[model samples]
Target: LIQTVKLRLFLLLLHWFHPYLLTTSSNSFPSFPLARERMKSQYVTNICLLILCLGAANNTPWPLLIFLASLLPLLHHTCRVPGGSAWRGVPAAPGPAGWPLLGCIPFMGPLAHRRLAELAASHGASRLMALTVGATRVVISSHPDTAREILCGSAFADRPPKEAARLLMFERAIGFSPSGEYWRHLRRVATGNLFCPRRIAAQEGLRQRVAGDMVRRVGYEMERKGSVELRGVLERGSLESMVGSLFGESSLGREREEELVGMVKEGYDLIGTFNWEDYFPMGGLLDFHGVGRRCKTLAEKVRSLVGEVIAERRRGGLHSHVGLGEDFLTALLTLPKEESLCDSDIVAVLWEMIFRGTDVVAILLEWIMARMALHPGVQAKAQQELSACLGGAQRAVRDSDIPKLPYLQAVVKEVLRLHPPGPLLSWARLAVRDVHVGKSLVPAGTTAMVNMWAITHDGSVWADPWAFRPERFLE
Candidate 1:
């Protein structure tokens, strides 16, 4: 009776202090699981106390002994058996030890990619190694061949569900969507209309105009202030090209362009920033990092802006074109009536193209410029090649000049080889079925990551892998 009274008092105390113990914001995600877990804990405690009372009332040790014995198997499984060992016939790849439920999240630092590469290298595994990050089982491919083996097939093409992909991107973005008819349709539409060779060639004038404007802007800034910032110019030019291709140059005013660029930058940073909610299912409820909240806000802003543009285009009956040629938005809008997409899907495609296309070009240009600044000899060689290709007539480099400028192209290739923008090529691919990736047995449901960084930096694969030697390609 005394023990029961004490238990009741404890429960009352817990209920009274619950609000004080767990503080949550009004806009926070639901925390019903928190209450559920607490209730479960209390119920277990009550059951244990009742069992003790029964034992004492009967004056028998047998009941208590039997109950303790019953728990042995459960305890043994939780302690002795690791999470991954449950899958029979699947070979366990070498990886770090993990605590129950938590997995290897505690060990992962800020530089997770670099840390993963280090772990993979240290294990001296054949080609692949597995690590449990939070609840997710991930396999990192340490070699190019292993990466190809895993990624080459459709079996590993499905993307794992990520909070950012859902909340920030609305799960409509082609990059995050699962492999299906819709994905295939999106890819087909993109490749056939937006990225075909003929369409790309037609955008040459648009690219030249953007580049020329950037050059003029840089000259004005330098002449006025004796200095110029490349980031603003590069980002603006790249943003214009992508936006013009999507909504056309006439569709966006200066204000809209700035707004789109700002939102795009925020979206990029938010997506790139890791959110714990993805790994920990219940982690979103707390959202201590505020990643989810920020993403939600950014997604709302982007959706609203993109929706307005689409609405305006529809209302105005604008046949928006790029460089006086057909545009991607026009193609999407002009799709057959039978092949109609909802407004949300169309916005997603447009947003994704704008987000991806702008960042890639701008970031690559920044990287190449940085490399040139660091290696003047290489820059001089590229400049000489450009002059030779242009015949020293003070003419801007053109699309036609790209093929003829071997040394210039070589430098770009070397940069790409050394510093691939997507170092983790095709990140977060999920295995749909059991597959063997270069002697490594990757079971279905395993999250596979092709560590391109590890592959590129492997000394065995490349001679003097650390050196930034662009001339290596020339040789």
Candidate 2:
């Protein structure tokens, strides 16, 4: 029944996007609401029926009752605040009105972030705006001041505790974990133990070794094929770097690496894909889109893989290789049992770190390289700067030499400005309480997102914003 319902929604989406995809003629009126303005009536009617059906299946009749009880008032345009008119005094920041209940969901295509950036750009000097998505209201902050108010402050620290994220991530991973004692503890442990300066310095030799391997692989490919696939090389290098840091370098071979990478990528895609279940709470129990089912399967696989590694480490103290002695697992194991985290917690932390770090580095590097390849003048300038810094030395540039290569650093920064891997920085942040960002008052429970892409591209904020001019950073 859930699958059938999902198919209906899928068809609705298809009709919403491309009417031609269905067998129906373009001239025919839509079976559902054709005018987006009046979709609220149909949206509520269908959702009520859906809730009743879902409630019957689960033998819990209260869900349908509860939804209708709350929805009736909204249908009558009752004031959210008692004794006051709707949204009185507290103004909703400017944005598209969208459809009645569905809000802007139908209009947001695959390039949603870019679309948002376009919206932000049109607002001139205004850095904050509001968007209604389904039942949720989202606040988009496109300026540094507004972003800092939401990010640096504690009022908007928590993430939206979505069902898919909680179920798959167990709400234990640092990224998904709510803002509380546990999250703070995890952050402290991660920063102090995993990424401390001392620990980083200790891994210098290991990083150098990985760099050597990447250089050799690139050289071999160039010599044999007369060219090299940069992305593949970078991806492998990134994976190896993270894997080597987590477990011993020998723990993952090329075959295992390829297999695990595929699994990880699929897992990421499934988790990231928009699930209607997330927006509407009733869909959580219904499994309407099978997103929850897929997440459950993927979660099991991830747990099995992470658990095996932990079990192996417990059985054998550390790898025979001295280089593996400083791996994160080894460090985790060394902490006093009373003070240390549980095995489950450790696994979540390590997996989250590895999952996030690997792809990001590769993506950023690929973007930088691609930009360099496109702009010969900028590339030449960076090379000249590197040559001046290195003084014609044949040896590879070391970490210590980075500060000396200003032009190269500028190029990297420019690439980051032009093409951030996560265009929407800190993707989704939920307000725990009513918060004031600049002049706007973001009510409690509002989902806020920083449009870093918008900030980076704003013509007022940046001179010649669209151009890929690395030299702009130098001045």
Candidate 3:
């Protein structure tokens, strides 16, 4: 009778402790298959549970002890697991180690450009240096070769994930669209109509004519007053020239031109302002933040302006033809109303062309004038070239004359190298598939960017990278 009582007590203990043992074993196993085989026999778990309980009864504290023993492996594994591996198991480029969750947010202050340069200098070349500004990971690649590979390679051709695309494209702009058939088609159309050799040559005449007008306007201002507001004058003249050339008529009055210029400036200003929501997806919900509100407002204003232009063109009943100099609006409106080329398509393309073209030209002109003012030697050389080419026959220089003037061309190239309008060259592709870049594995969905600024300044590629030497072109 005493033996039967002991056996029943042992069975009760097994029943109580069997589940805990099984649970512990499953948790401890590295893989599912190992856990399954161990669990296949209930009798084995029962025997182990009985032995454990007997040990507990002997004042060994086996239950509590066993629980802790089961947990240690998991704890150790959790603590020892390394963070995400850098490209090809290469140690992440040495940058300031960031705080947990926040990650490098505190370091990026007002001047991102200076801060980035400083970081790159501190971190050795080809090392992975990363900063999480808000939620976006700003990975710095100090290698010009890497930058070139990413930009030229077909694998990385998509835009970075950002709010700018949605706002700028209105779900249709080609600049922000994914690189695919649609983008290819849009690019072909734009190149054929606007950027083709013939079209560009034709536009050169207009550009030269405008440049002449600009010089005259500056001279007038100089005559009126030794120092005039160059910014305002240049801004107005550039926009008017672009609009006039596009429409084949100067429909934009002073008030309208100023309004458009203000809108465009605001749009660009908004782009420069850091928006935390863009990098951190969840943060975007805070529309109260000025960036989100400003983007929406600017987008609406630009769209309305574009819509009005489209409406005017439609009302005029213009027909599209190749090589006819029909103007951008007329040429777009005249495209056969096919599924591929619709009115909305025309509007989006035209809007992008005007905004991008006008902004680039205006910025380039500003840089050229600023540089000329700063470097008297360069300005003198350029003036000499201009005089030699034009023979002082006219105050204005022609586009035809630009090719002949090597110094002028060199000046433009130098300005572009020194102050590239888009320093980063826009966000490039997210790797859609694994690509081996050197020893590093560019994982799928990794954001890529071409650091044009860095490329232009690479010491190996350019002599005296920092100096504003237009004579580099002569070499």
Candidate 4:
């Protein structure tokens, strides 16, 4: 009885003060959103605890818990129009006055990159918008200059790792890893070993082989199934390209290659998933949809599989015929004392390289193919460039032939501009320190995202932005 009366008193007081606290004027409502979200979460937690305790003390039914849980969606993040005080202390950049707690998440559609671009155009000023997603405040940039200002700055060096990313050891890889000595070491390894001129030239044969194998597989499928499903074909070929580059050609047998491909798909799926926990400070405690668990499992599998391959290379067990230069595995084995990485760290680097490139190649190729199918004129021009470059001979396309075909290169560039695989650059950068992007100030701990899709299609930046004209590159 005492507890129930106390709860009733608290509720009465909350109801009385709720309207005054959520005022429309900047002077009344609190501007700092971190404090605001904390307070809101605290209220919900306290109310739930009080209700549960009240029900237990009085030996009432468990339906009270159910009722409270049901009301969570309706109770919080309501349509409270905050004033110009959305982004804490400073005057916020022009953007939407999102719901009370939910912010702009509900408005972002399935294709969030496209939606973010739309939001920037409609609600933003100077191609910049400040909005909240769950509890995390993000500053979205849709212009190339502003994006370059944000991305190229040393302040935006670190990344905001998602819950799954952290679970999957994001700190070890170059993709989401912290900016420090370790990241620099990885970069150095990439530059000196994997991407050197001689090594890239050696990989020309590997690319040619992968392309040929993909064509053969497509032909076989066309003869057998009477139609070509390019994604799967592209996926397998891309997987071979990535793994083969890292390890060696046909290093893994059919079974292991299949396993690796499946794992890559799973990893991509997990990374692409927008977990609500990723947005909030303590939201990981909720662990929606078992994403954390899945990521953990995937991380373990990646380490184990890649570790096995590393061990094989260390033992001189895996053979190679794909390149003139030593593969990434051999380079890792022979690294200088200063640049050496531990087994786990090495696996993480390899995982980033492998998983990052595989699906991207497939998606980009699919886009290029689709564009070619849509624009036969452009396709003919590209083919003419290729034929002229190859001297009208029926032979395999070599890497040396790439530089000679400017029209084909333009077609590829146009395809990339039209449809970027990782349109948001796969992940957002964390603003480590306060920085001014143009006239607006992006504070520390804010998530900064570059909408490349927006910049690539912006009318101000490009001539006839929506048209699929490969000749634009020729000019």
Best by lDDT: 4
lDDT, residue 272, candidate 4? 67
What local lDDT score does residue 1 receive in model 3, on the 0 to 100 scale?
Answer: 90
**Candidate 2 C-alpha lDDT tens digits along 1-475:** 9668655754554344332111334364432222332343444445655665675567665544555534643543432221112123557676544444556666455566676665554444247867666556777888878887877888888997576667667569999998888899888888876688776777776788888999999999999999999988887888888888777667757776786687667666766667776555565665656877887887777777878888887777654433424778777777766658888888788778777887789989999888888998988888888889889888777878988988888888999999877777346789999978888778888888887887788787899999999889889
RMSD of 3: 14.0
Backbone clash count for every predicted candidate, in the order shown: 0, 0, 2, 1
Provide the TM-score for each candidate, comma-separated: 0.79, 0.78, 0.75, 0.82
Q: In candidate 3, how many clashes are counted?
A: 2
Question: After TM-score superposition, what is the CA distance of residue 433 in candidate 3 from its true location, in Å?
Answer: 2.8
Q: How close is candidate 1 to the true structure, as a TM-score?
A: 0.79
For 1-475, candidate 4 gives per-residue lDDT tens digits of 9668656755664564444343343355443332343245455545656766676678765565447633643455443333122475655677765655667776555577776666555554536788777777788888888888887889999988677777675568876778898788889898888888888887888888989999999999999999999999999889888887888777778888898898888887887677878877777787767798899888888888888888877776434422365688777866778778888888888888888788989999998999989999988888878888878788998877778888888988999998866777454799998888888888888888888888889889999999999889999
Instruction: Please give the ranking of all candidate structures by lDDT, highest first, separated by commas.
Output: 4, 1, 2, 3
| Model 2: lDDT of residue 263 | 60
Colliding residue pairs in candidate 3: 93-128, 158-429
Error of 1 at 192 (Å): 0.7
By TM-score, highest first, what's the ranking? Answer: 4, 1, 2, 3
Q: Write candidate 1's Cα lDDT for 211-261 as tens digits.
A: 899999999999999998988889999999998778776678999999988
